[model samples]
Every structure is written in C-alpha cells, then in structure tokens.
Target: MSYSVHVLHNGYSYLKDGVMRANCTCTLIKGPNLVIVDTMTAWDKDVLLEGLAKENTSCADVKYAVGTHGHSDHLGNLNLFTAATHIVGYSVSYKDEFFIHPFETGEPYKIDDSLQVIPTPGHTTEDVSVVVKTAHQGTVVVAGDLFEREEDISDPSLWRYIAGSENPDKQQKYRNEVILLADHIVPGHGPMFKVTEDMKDVARRDQLTQK
Candidate 1:
C-alpha cells in the first residue's frame, strides 16, 4: 500500500527569552493507520495539534508515536499522544497511560507493508530512522539526527562534531548505509531533499576515512 507523509515543521527555530530553541522536524504518516514520527517540543504542542487538525486528524487518531531518540525537542510532546502507542529506545523512560515499546538494534518494527522502523543509530546510540515506501517516492527515510541536514552528507564529519557521537566510526557506517539505501530523506532539522549520487560518493569517502 502507498502512504502519504506530511512534514509538520521543517527545521523550525525561534528565539525564546534570548535562547535559540530549535524544533525538530516532525512528520505525520498517513497510511492504514496514523503514525507520528518525532513530536516537536512541548511548546509546539498547539502547532502539532493544528497540523493534525488540518489533516482532519487529532491526537486521538494517532495509533503510534515514534521517537527517533530521547531528546527534548524530539519527544517533548510525546505525552500528548495519550491514545497512541509510544515507541522509543530501551533507555528512554516516560510516564504515560499508553503502551510504550522499546526497540533494539537490528529489530525492524513493521508498521505496515510500506513503513518499517529500523535502527539507524548515528546521532545517538538509540537513534532510529523510519523507511517509508511512497507511491511517488520509492523509499523515503525519516532520519532523525542521523542527518541533521543534507550538508551532513557532503561534510560527514559535521555529524560527529555536532552530535558528539560516542562511536563516530559506527555512526559513519550506519549513516553511509542509510545514504546508500534511501532515495529521499527528511532530516532531523532540515527540509526533505533528494539523496544524490554526489552525496552518496561523499558519504562513501567519509566511510573510508573512518576505517
């Protein structure tokens, strides 16, 4: 089955009390069931709800809420999805009424025939990326901090620098794997962009450097 993915916020950032608050990219996947990938910060709760309302969906309609990792900006509004199943890494802890399932590496959670949640683990040890097969876009990946932006592919070292990755080598390996597999990617804090041959070459070079 084909699915539609909507970007609620594409790398949105704002100033709050002189502090720059970055909002992670939040996506809503509409398929056999409603699934939300990475709910934005708590302050963006209204914005998230508004986006869902525009789609004729509310928090109640969401069946699953998946967090790429346990970051404030990524899982801040997680509690709002009280009716949906919350999926996160085993290390994450939350108090909610809904069921919370923790996923481990190498275990792919199939949301549907078109959507599969796979552990990408680059930006953080617990990171996961969602792979969606759309009718128009063959394989679209919802990458969390795995790729903050498209530039990360060209400058792969930036991910290690910015994320302060514990296992930089492993991160680069997983990132290269994702780059080779995904056709298009929705980054954690950037607009969706096509995965180009040039990007793949750059990623390959970065992978070689990690050896």
Candidate 2:
C-alpha cells in the first residue's frame, strides 16, 4: 500500500481551477496508520475517507482522530472517524461527552514518543497545539488557531477577545506555553515559521515585554 500525506491549505485553495475554498487547515498524515489533524468546513466523512483511501489507508485504521480544539472548523468531521479513538485535552473533553465519545488525553498519547501535545487554551477553552520531533523535520509545532502567521497574529482585537473571554487567566497561561516552545511554528491557517534560536529569542523577548 502506498503511504502519503496531503496538506490542504486553508486559504488560496480556490486558486486551483476556481474551486471553492473550505474552512480550517486539513492535514492527513498516513504512515503505518492514519491521523487527521483538522477537518475543515464543507468537508464530510465520506469525502475525507475517500481521499484517505487513495493512500491505501482506510478509515478503519485511523487510530487517532484529533482536533486542536472544540471549534466547529476543527471538529467538523469528527464523526467520520468514530471507529478511531479521539484525542483532546482534558479541559474540553466535556464538549464531546454529549456525543458519548471516548477521548484520551492528548499529552499522554505520544506518536513514536517524539510528538507531544501542549495544552494552550484561550483562543478557546480547549485549544491545544501539537509538537513533533521527526528525524527529518526536527522540532515542529502544529499550532492550531492558538497562533497564526497572518497580520491577525498580533491583532489587538483578537488578543483582547482571548484575554477577556470566559477564561481570562488562561490567556496568560496559553501565552506562557507558547513562549516555552523553541521549535518551528506551524499555524493552522498560514505559512509555517522556521523556529530558529534567534526567533525564539525574539518571541521570548516579546512575551517578557508584554508582561
């Protein structure tokens, strides 16, 4: 069976022969098993399963179906992977309780003992980011909504919304968690950032300055 991956760019998807653009960033990582990061809007179970089957991996082997948060965009197609175990941080596990879904803790479930999950809420109550250490990719962070590359990354309104939301104190905690990451930053909706030592220094400096 052929193993491959597909990184569906959130924006600029319409440039391909004038097709419609979808929601959140969708990533299908297929190896011995299958793992989907986020399921964008307008995408359903059949479409995702069909696309994944192209790589010779069926939805049945989807050992892990996870979301960075409870947002509609991220968890839109979660029902498609019902057979697979769901992974989400403890803070937002209640959201899936109604569905009678059994979800494991993101931090404890490691992929090859190299990838880790850092719970960084504030964008929402259950937002989390995935950190990976691959032989080829080195250290990388899959920051879902918690961080972005667009100008909105530091927009005052967004920050205010996060800081003044239902969990205001958690905002600082989330920022602190991000500051601890000295690895490459990959956002859910923008270009990835090479996390160099210099960039980490800048990010830490900015965090301290904000404090």
Candidate 3:
C-alpha cells in the first residue's frame, strides 16, 4: 500500500520576555496502518481530536501513536490511544506491556514498503523520525527536533542555543543525514519545508562551527 504524510497540527516555539513556550507538531501517516506521530501537548486535547475528525479519522483509526522522543510536549496525549501501539523514543509498548524492538540504535524500523521509522537521536538519545515514501513529495521525513524550524537552517541558534539541544555536536550530524535524505521535512516545532541548497549549506556549516 502507498503512504503519505499529513500535518494535523503545526508546531511552534517562541520566547516571551525570557519565557519559552512550545508544542510539538502532530503528523499522520495515511496508509494500510495509520500512524500518528507526535501527539502535541496534553492541553491541546480538544484541538487534536478536532484535527483528526477533520481528516475523517477517529482515535481508533490510528494503529500507531509515535512520540519522536519522550518530551512532554510531544507524547502528552499518548494515553488517548491505548489500543494502538505506542512507539516512544526507542521503546514500543501496548498499555502496561513493553515490547522489544530493533529501532533502538540501528536501522530504520520498516512498517511497510512505503513507511519506516528511523532512529534519529541528538535531540535526545532515543529520538526517532517517521519516513514516508510519497509520490508527489518523494520522501517526507517527519523529523522531530532534528530539523527544528525551516528558519533554523539560516539561524542555527534558534534550535541549538535557545531551544536547548542536548547534544549540538551529535544533532548537527543527524541534521545533515536527514537533509540529504528528505525532499521535505516536517520539523518538531514549525511548518514543513521543501529542501533547498541553503538548508544543505546550513547543515554542512555546523561542522565548521564546531572547529
């Protein structure tokens, strides 16, 4: 079956007089087994439900609820999908039962020919991203904080410094990896963007910044 990526909720992060506020992007993978990536914050419950309804999907329609990482803003609504498999960070589980999965530190977990989940750390060691093969877009990577926002390509500080990167050095490496592979990236806290040379340059520039 074919798969496509859809953003249910666009994420954002901004500073308000020294205080930072943010929410993670929520994305849906439409295919044989529907997958929802990054549930956003818990407070956005009503909005999330409405977003799913708008897509003609219900909570039960989603087979997988994936949290790119264990951040509160990303996995807050996990409880709503008890029937679906929850892939948070490197671990997979169904309610109270945890399951072992090889997505841990190597190789992308293949869901089907059209979709897979890659192990993309650096935002946090356990971070992961959903990669979907779409006909129009080619390859769409629902990267978590790995890309941040499209603006982060020009101003790395927005994601590395202000947003708090656990490992800027490691983050830069994965940033380059994803940029090279994806035609479009759905970032953790911003709108999706088409890959451009500038984005590639920024990813490469990070190596120089460290020197």
Candidate 4:
C-alpha cells in the first residue's frame, strides 16, 4: 500500500523577546489510515489543527499520533488528538479514553502495510522515526532529532543540543542507520530533503570520525 506524506511545518528556532523558541517538524501520513508523526509545540496547536483542517482532515480522523521522542516541542499537543491512539517511547497518562502506547527500540510497530514506527533513539532514549512507503517518494522517514537538518549528518556538534544524549557513539550509530534507511527525510527541525548517495557518504565519513 502506498501513502502520501504532508509536512505541516518545517521547524526552526529563533529568538522572541530574548527567549529561544523552537518548533519541531510535524508530518501527516495519509493512506488506508491517517497518521500524524509529530505535533510540534503547544503554541503551534492552533496552526497544526488549522493545517489539518485546510487539508480536510481533523484530529478525530487521525488513527495514530506518534511522537518521535519525549521532547516538549514534539509531543506538546498530543492531548489535542484525543481521538487518535498516542504512541510514545515513554509512559504518560491521559484522562480521556485515548490509549497511550509505548514502543521499544529494534522493533518496528506496523500501523498499516505502508507505515511503520521504527526506533531511532539518539536525541532521546525513546526516540522513534516513522517510515512511510509513499506513492511518489518511495520510503520517506520522519526522523525526529535523529537528523535535525541536512547538515546535522556531517556536523557532530549539532548533537550537542540533544537532551539526555550522553552516549555520543551510540547516537552516531543510530544516525547512520536512519540515514541509510531513509530515501527522503523530514527532519525534526528542517525542511524535507532527499537522502542521496552524497549524503550517505557524508554520514559514513562522520561515523568513521566518531570511531
């Protein structure tokens, strides 16, 4: 089964009143089932919902709401999708009938034939990236902080902002694995881009450097 992936936001960080505010990229997968990858920040709830409305989709239509990690920016608005199944790496409580599911690393949770949630822990111990088999793009990976942007693959320093990422070696390994697994990547905080051979080579070089 093939699906269509839509990027609701190309995340970025900027200063507002001398305070840093960031938004994580949010993506929606439309196929046999509707799936929302990330929910950006709490402040973006309105925009996110509006974007879905513009697409003729609503939170109630979402079958699954999967957060790439536990970061506030990525899972802040999860409660808004009360009609969808919430999947996360860590445990959380919700007052509604909505079920909160927990996923582990190395296991791919199949939402449908076209969508799979694969653990890509690096930014956080529970980070998971969603792999969607798209009709036009082949395999598209909604990588959370695994690859924040295209340059993050080659820049080790970019990992510095990853909260609780203590194992740099393991993190680099996961990064390489995600890049190899994705044909196109919707990074956690940047526009979607193709994962070409050149990008793979760069990731390889970065891996070697880390070793």
Which is the leading candidate under TM-score?
A: 3
Across 84-184, the per-residue lDDT of candidate 3 in tens digits comes to 99889898888889978786557787888888888988889889988888878889999998878989877989879877788887788888889978899
For all candidates, the clash counts are 0, 0, 0, 0
Top candidate (lDDT): 3
Q: Where is the poorest 10-residue window by lDDT in model 4?
A: 91-100
Lowest summed lDDT window (length 10), candidate 2: 98-107
TM-score for candidate 3: 0.92
**Local accuracy of candidate 1 as per-residue lDDT tens digits, 29-116:** 8878788988988788888988888888889888878898888889889888877777774333334443334555477777778888
Assess the local accuracy of residue 156 in candidate 1 as a C-alpha lDDT between 0 and 100. 59
Candidate 1 has which clashing residue pairs, if any? Answer: none
Give lDDT for model 4.
0.78
lDDT of 1: 0.79
Global lDDT scores for all candidate models: 0.79, 0.57, 0.87, 0.78
| Rank ordering of all candidates by TM-score, starting from the highest | 3, 4, 1, 2
Steric clash pairs (candidate 2) = none
Per-residue CA lDDT of model 2 for 8-53, tens digit only, reads: 4442122246553335666666555466777665455565666677
- Among all windows of 10 consecutive residues in model 1, the one with the lowest summed lDDT is 90-99
Q: Candidate 4: where is the Cα deviation over 4 Å?
A: 14-19, 90-105, 161-164, 204-211
